[model samples]
Target: MMDKMMATLLESLHEATQRLEQAVAVKESNPDDWLAILDEREELIHQMQERFSAGSVLTEAQRVQLTQIYEVNQRLIPLIEGCKQGVQQQLNNLHRSKLAMNSYNEAGPNGYGAFFDRKK
Candidate 1:
């Protein structure tokens, strides 16, 4: 039973990594697709984390496998974070531009428009 649980946990981690890679690669092309990938990966990670927290004893080989997974994750996490930051920055810039345009389009005063500086 322990071996089975370990196998499932390792499998989950591996699959999550692969899916995360795909999401990162195509993030700009179709962000909606990446969102779906994120949902699936989150479920897998949750299951894997539960298994890991159960205090199961891992053999040397299993420990080695887990270590490899950890190393890969260490490298991938920062890259993913950077990608997320870039996407957020783009969204922020877009929102700022939209607000600026809206403000500029607002009537100057009393519907007189920007051409007239004084109502008289």
Candidate 2:
């Protein structure tokens, strides 16, 4: 039988995983919300590690629950990677546009040309 702390941590992990799934399912999910869920999951995992590393063994059910969490994570990896790539592409495009604008401004006609008016 799992200890109470372990059970609670596992339940929290399960809930975090559900939130992650929902976040991934939405096409326009907020990255901040997804990241918050991930952060919560990481904290729960750390808590579980601290609690379980004291020469404790997991019961079969606990092992199964962990395995399920692992499976869900595996499935999410590709989707997460895709999202990362999309964001990276957007950043790259923005950077290129900024550089182009900067170059254009640098090569542009400065106000010096307008200062010496021919009709002055």
Best by TM-score: 2
- TM-scores for every predicted model: 0.65, 0.84
For all candidates in order, the CA lDDT equals 0.70, 0.85
Regions of candidate 1 where Cα sits further than 4 Å from its true position: 26-55, 108-120
**In lDDT terms, how accurate is model 2?**
0.85
Best by lDDT: 2
Taking the tens digit of each residue's C-alpha lDDT, what string does model 2 give over 1-120? 458888888989988998898899788898899999999999999988898786556788988988999999998889989998999999999999999777666664657555322322
Query: What local lDDT score does residue 53 receive in model 2, on the 0 to 100 scale?
Result: 85
lDDT of 1 by residue, 4-89 (tens): 87677676767766766766666465656656766876786677677668866667777787787678668767877787788899
